[model samples]
Target: MKVIIVGYGRMGKEVEAICAQRKHTIVAKVDPVCGDAPALTKELADQADVAIEFALPESAYDNVKLYTELDLPAVCGTTGWYDRVDEFRNLVTQSSIGYLYGSNFSIGAHLFFKLVARAAQLINPFPEYDIMGFEAHHNRKKDSPSGTALSIANIILENVERKKTILTDKCDHSINESELHFASLRGGHIPGIHKVIIDSEADTIEVSHSARNRGGLALGAVLASEWLKDKKGFFNIDDFISERLKYTQMI
Candidate 1:
């Protein structure tokens, strides 16, 4: 497939390398430095089967809408554009285009989320325990708490009846027993760390996923590209799970 890269920074470069390893073509790259207004030329636009976007939060909304408006399927990894998610969904639905967005594209991270959700469901019946979330990322990272952390918090919230909300600090006021605490730390060169800790009178249980580098994310993005090639409408990593499991069952 001919893929256009919308960000030529760290993640975008990694995506390019992964595409090469998979024998896929990188047709064009649009970086922020390229120009102001930062629009794609028709020639570059014509060469793409899909566009893979890993731009910054500020540029993500415009970048995604541009390509999808042009009727190209897009797989986006850029976070912080979620404030306009309803607009994105509307655009995708109206255009009959495909848009797949995930906070983290690592296969391991996605699987970790699935496992955490199931575990939360199992542990929810026991009222003695409560859950909290913590995340760490590289200092250079923009978004705090990381997207994967929020996803995990959502999983815990959905399954655990005790947590009705996620907070950044310990609640001084009386909050719901089921509420989740989110602690975010930014330091060093940490790729990502997300831990879900369940505390109780007896003991504490923690489940976490740590990323060594960008390889997992690069690989997962390629897989997502392949999955998006023939799919239409809005989707997420959750859809990939059942499909992957079904394939595993067949094999």
Candidate 2:
């Protein structure tokens, strides 16, 4: 497979390494600082089978737009610019190009989302059980509470009837029982840590996912790229995971 890396930063380098290990060819890189190519023109995009984007949030929309315009399949792992997701969805639908985006491209984290959802569903009817979410990342991380944490919270809100909203800010007074409080901590060099706590007066249950490094995320992104090489239309990690599970069931 011929691949173009859209960002040459830490995650981009990791994607490059994984793609090489998987025997895929790197046709070009499109970062201003460490880009192997000058710019992300249609000519450069035409050289690769697909593009994997891990660029900054400010540039992610433009990068995806260019790839879709060129009819190039793209797998994007950038977060924090999701307000325009509806716009990109329309673009991908109209252009009929393949595009996959995820907040965190870790297979384990995806599974963790499912597990958290199921837990929330099982705990929904129990009024005594209260749920709260907490996530911590490296200080250099851009978004507070992290996108992965938000994904986890969204799943819970969808499944648990009581959690109608998500609150990320620090709570000065007592938190409402109907609101799901999400606390974020940024410090040190922590790769990532997310926890969903379910508590009652009698018992407490906690489910967590902790990443030791970026390998899981990079591998998942490369895997998504390979899966998206020949496909068309917009997708997310859930679609990828669902397809894989179907394949596994058939086997």
Task: State the C-alpha lDDT per candidate.
Answer: 0.81, 0.89
**So what's the TM-score on candidate 1?**
0.85
Candidate 2 lDDT over 1-251, as tens digits, reads 99989888999999999998999999998888979885688887778899898989999778777887788899999876889999889889888689999877899998888789889989989999999989999989887978778888899899988889899999887888778999999999999999999999999999999999998999999999888878999999778988997888831
Q: Give lDDT tens digits, candidate 1, residues 18-126.
A: 9999989988878857523155666777778888888889987777678666878888988878888888888787776788888778888878887888779988898
- TM-score of every model? 0.85, 0.90
Error of 2 at 74 (Å): 1.2
Measured by TM-score, the strongest candidate is 2
Off by over 4 Å in 2: 249-251
Q: Cα lDDT of model 2 overall?
A: 0.89
- How far off is residue 224 in model 1, in Å? 0.6
